[model samples]
Target chain A: MEQALYQAAILTFEELGFIFPIERPSDDECENEESTRVSVKFNGSVSGEIVLQVENTILPTIASNMLGTEEPLEDEEILQDVLGELANVICGNTLPSIAGKNEVFRLEPPRKINKLEAGEKPAAIAHLDVEESRADVLLYLN
Target chain B: MKISSRSDDILITYALGSCLGITIFDPIAKVGGLLHVMLPASIVNPAKAANNPYMFVDTGVPELFKACYKAGAKKERLVLKVAGGASLQNNEDSDQFQIGKRNFLMLRKLLWKNNVLIKAHDVGENFSRTMLLEMSTGNVILKINNETTIL
Candidate 1:
């Protein structure tokens, strides 16, 4: 089941115009079950976080992509939209695989979070980071 | 002249690929309106006119204008700004999802008929965007990820 989830992340990236690799979260970031965090690192400073929950994943990729520019990035609003879309796309791709076909899942529009508060309880959290030259995708299932 | 208000402000959100968000503000009347329209025109989904009025340009634009007018806005004083209509993932695998380009074209036609002009806009890209229009001051904010820009 975990491998399937990882494969889905990779497939989503390929479908979403990002190039990267997948890996496990470091020991320091491990948490309880029902929460997952996936991290993927890509070239050009394009890194993103995917926080999974029963309702939705706080996909922070849209913000990352906007900020992941070769030029010095300085916009906050665009960053938020980018992260929201990233989370939306990652969650949209992963939800169907976890839940069976019959299960109906509706994703709310992605919202921006200034910080990932400590000790915040979520069903799952996933973090993904994609780079231009290489990419890293990490899933931290709670 | 039409102006629309949603409680304290009007919240219009657009999603999916290659779709745009158009917001009109009439400062004189202190009225603001937003539309999270998907396609450029009704041709994309002519059959679902009554169901998803907000999803098409033809019906949605008129409705948005009417809503504004009802709230006490005039056509001459309206200010317009647009966002969205992005294509972060360009895939030719299907034609059903070419909503971004069609949406832009439809908006152009509708505005032309009404003699409405767009002042500022952010459109066409592979990235998705979410926009907010504040009615109090007619402030338009665009969000992408960690960055926020007032346009």
Candidate 2:
């Protein structure tokens, strides 16, 4: 299961074109669980966590790539939507592997979490930080 | 046009990307309805019951069926056609978000318990799709990008 999760994560990262081998998030970086955090966690027959954070500099670039428009979108809602979609893609791509061959797994909707309140439980969290990009991805098992 | 009938025509449409859409229709009375549901069920937002009842599978399916029956559609004559469980770009990250699969499974479970059988369906894969159901003829057309296919 762990191997599957790792492969899924690596495959997702490569497909999305986001360079990684990146740093995993630390306690300090994720100080507040209540703050707006673009995190993806799975629970059910198969469970895990995936988190993403975008650098301020790369935010506009990613926004442009996602929207396919040169015009800037400064709205928080738009940014959140794009990030949510990104997380959704990552989760969808990794399911078959995590759930095993012929195992069907269902996913809940991607939601923005308060970072401060995220780690209250001692779960097996795999924190992934994509560097040189405007986004961050985190994964944990709770 | 949009055939909003209780039993015969249930027409629902939506932009589906890694999301599922379930449609239920009854032909005898020509009253049917469609639901562009995003999630498997409304576990997060019970507050949305009054306004967006169709957002969850459990709530929306029953409402759609009831609405059809009210319009003189018989449950025995109903034929179901489903579409819109598509995936986004393939990636590991995408697997963590299984709204499409969850939505599909939940709908199936609900329908099974109610003794409803899905006659036809198109689900899964990494493609964005749009679905439209013609209530008058019980015809379903799926559009993925520029390609159009009847399912």
Candidate 3:
């Protein structure tokens, strides 16, 4: 399940967000620990949440790439919306792989959130390096 | 879950859509704690709950209170504030999995059972929220749509 989720995230980033991710085993290989997070809750065939946390500095690049614009995006709102949309896309793609092709799933809108709290362990957490920025995806299945 | 005692520390919790963020602060003790709960019940996944109480409302709420007490925050002197419990926008047909509504109700139930009353709260909406607790003054700020509001 974790591997499936990681692949789905990579596909979404490359195809939809125009970003590429490289797997990193440790934070020492990345720049800093600071990140921006978003989560989308899903129901139907299965229930759980998909959370994506990305390094803050790379948000502008993500937003610009997703929008296909070269101009620098100075707006925080656009960047957050892009992050939420990316989480939504990742959840939509990952669910079918986990729940099977015959199952149907309904997803909640993605929202910007704080870091994952202690004790709420993710079923699968993947760390990806995106152009020197660190991005993590956590899957919590119920 | 996080706890703070220094006046300079600011506690914050984000992305409370369908989840709940709770804070308890005691001005006298100069202590504060923040908890972010993801689900309404631990019974669905008892194994996970056993190790991580903060994942469920029923189990997490109590543990949060206990932690505050341990940090020198008196129950009576504690000011409780809550935020989050938002559903997805344009998602009205699926009432069977209204996790946000359920999460909030469970929180209220547990708090009431403990004879604890919420001083302020923001719940049930289609918007995401980020909450902050300033330990210096016990003031809680809710951030939504890039605007901050006192709660």
Candidate 4:
């Protein structure tokens, strides 16, 4: 499950956002950076959610790159929207690798989470670093 | 937040933004409580939370349940409902202060840790809300804009 999340994040970020995620990233790399969290819920053969937490520092680059713009976007919502789409795509890719392509699933629109308190354990987690920023993909199964 | 044993008492909370409005009711006891919490954790400012526990989710939730228990509400029979976590992200000057989302997350984390499940919720959006609880029937009501409905 962690591998699936990592793979999805790698593919989505590289292809769509033009950023490469570092494997086996240093845990302390992003300790002091702000993080933006987004998640997409899916229901069908299984019900659960996939979460993406990215360092806020690299969001502008990711958003602008995904939109084919060289300059950073002027709107914050656009960056949030891109993160939402990133979660959606990563979720779309993740379910298939785990559940097989035969299974059908319905995914809800992505939503941003403001803050996450102490640990609420997930089924699996993939932690990576990108552009000196950190990205974590958490999978929750219900 | 208020707890009522009176059959005709109405507990209502208004203009809930990123703040969380939690309602707990016990049908058998005819007791109900409404809680409105502004911040996620009391640790942000211990002085404020110590003075008014209702200002934060961590402190307010425990207080809400304790009060309900004192008012004769059994934890096992309590029906919990939540509302109000908004972003205010509409139009040009959108405000992305995600206090509402933070409050909702903190509430969920706290509830999950205590083995509590929310029966219903009308949460997360770009609009403000007003929540009401009827002590008579334990019906939770949500009023947004000109609309009113059961939550």
**CA-lDDT, candidates in order:** 0.56, 0.61, 0.83, 0.83
* Model 1: residues with Cα > 4 Å off, grouped in runs: A1-142, B1-16, B90-97
Q: Which regions of candidate 3 deviate over 4 angstroms?
A: A1-142
Evaluated against the true structure, the overall lDDT of model 2 is 0.61
TM-score of 2: 0.49
Candidate 1 TM-score to native? 0.46
The parts of candidate 4 lying over 4 Å away from their true place are: A1-142, B91-96
TM-score of chain B of each: 0.84, 0.86, 0.96, 0.95
Model 3, C-alpha of A44: deviation from truth (Å)? 45
- For A1-142, candidate 1 gives per-residue lDDT tens digits of 3444556655554344223333445232533342222322211111223443211122234233233332323354554444445446665555555555555554556553333446644334333334312222233333
- Residue B144's lDDT within candidate 2 is 79
Superposed Cα deviation of residue A121, candidate 1 (Å): 72
Error of 4 at A91 (Å): 7.5
Least well predicted 10-residue stretch by lDDT in candidate 4 chain B: B91-100
The fnat score for candidate 1 comes to 0.00
TM-score of each: 0.46, 0.49, 0.51, 0.57
lDDT: the better of candidates 2 and 4: 4
TM-score-superior candidate, 1 or 4: 4
